[model samples]
Target: MDKDLEHRFITQLEKHQNIVHKVCRIYTSGQDEHNDLFQEITIQLWKAFPKFRGESKFSTWMYRVALNTAITLYRKSKKSVRGDHYEHVLNNLKYNEYNDEEEQQLKLMYDAIKQLSDVEKALIFLYLEDRSYKEISETLGITEVNARVKMNRIKSKLRTILNP
Candidate 1:
């Protein structure tokens, strides 16, 4: 890549790196795996950057690439230790309780989300990010209707796990 292009890519990536980190947290367990996935996503982003047409928001494009790389390249290991960083961040949520009741509830919700399949996780991640159905459809290569249906199912599944 040319210096100008490389500089631009780095600047844009630095601005949106939090998107990468969030995807890593959702997709990987264990610190080592999270780091590995983050690097892999960055590499994928750099490779794909040359082709980015600026037709969408950079963060939206970044999410598509990052989510695809994570889904394809970073299969969670069976022996993987769940990442603690998620809980650390959740611990700081405004609603966190001194008695830790909210913390416990969040832990249960996170565990339930953890049990979701990779594709479902991607869907929920996009949903939680407040991506429009059209954007989720574009990112996931599904129809808007399918995205909605799948989101409904994912919500039902999570509700079952969290409530049961």
Candidate 2:
């Protein structure tokens, strides 16, 4: 790629790298797996960049590529811990702002989310990120109605897991 294009790609990647990290968070178990998946996603994104048509918003496009890469690689790892070790940055920061009860609740929620399938994880992650149904469907290549339906089901599933 030319320097101009390379610079553009690097700028976009740097601006939206958190999307990739969030995808990695939901699909990988530990730092090693997370780093591996992150690198693979970057490679995939770079390979696909040349063909990016700019039809969709860059962040939306980034999410699609990141989610697809994470889900695919996550399925291929036979011994995957399946995001069981995933932790929010807040906890790692040792903020001490949240009490023990809040921390416990957050852990329980994370545990329930970890039990979801890869696709479900992707869906919930997007939904939690405040993406619209249309955008989520676009990112996942599904219909708007399907996105809403799946999100409802996922919420119910999480409720069951966290409650029962």
The CA lDDT of each predicted structure is 0.76, 0.76
Candidate 1 deviant stretches above 4 angstroms: 76-106
Residue-level lDDT tens digits of model 1 in 8-117? 77778777887887787777656677776766777777778889999999999999999988877756442332445334322322321123243354566667888999
Candidate 1 lDDT trough over 10 residues, lowest sum: 89-98
Which tens-of-lDDT digit does each residue in 50-143 have in candidate 2? Answer: 8999999999999999998887776777333333222322112221121234335456666788899888998999998899999999999999
Best model per lDDT? 1
Model 2 score (lDDT): 0.76
Where model 2 places Cα greater than 4 Å from the true spot, the runs are 78-106
- Candidate 2, run of 10 with poorest lDDT: 89-98
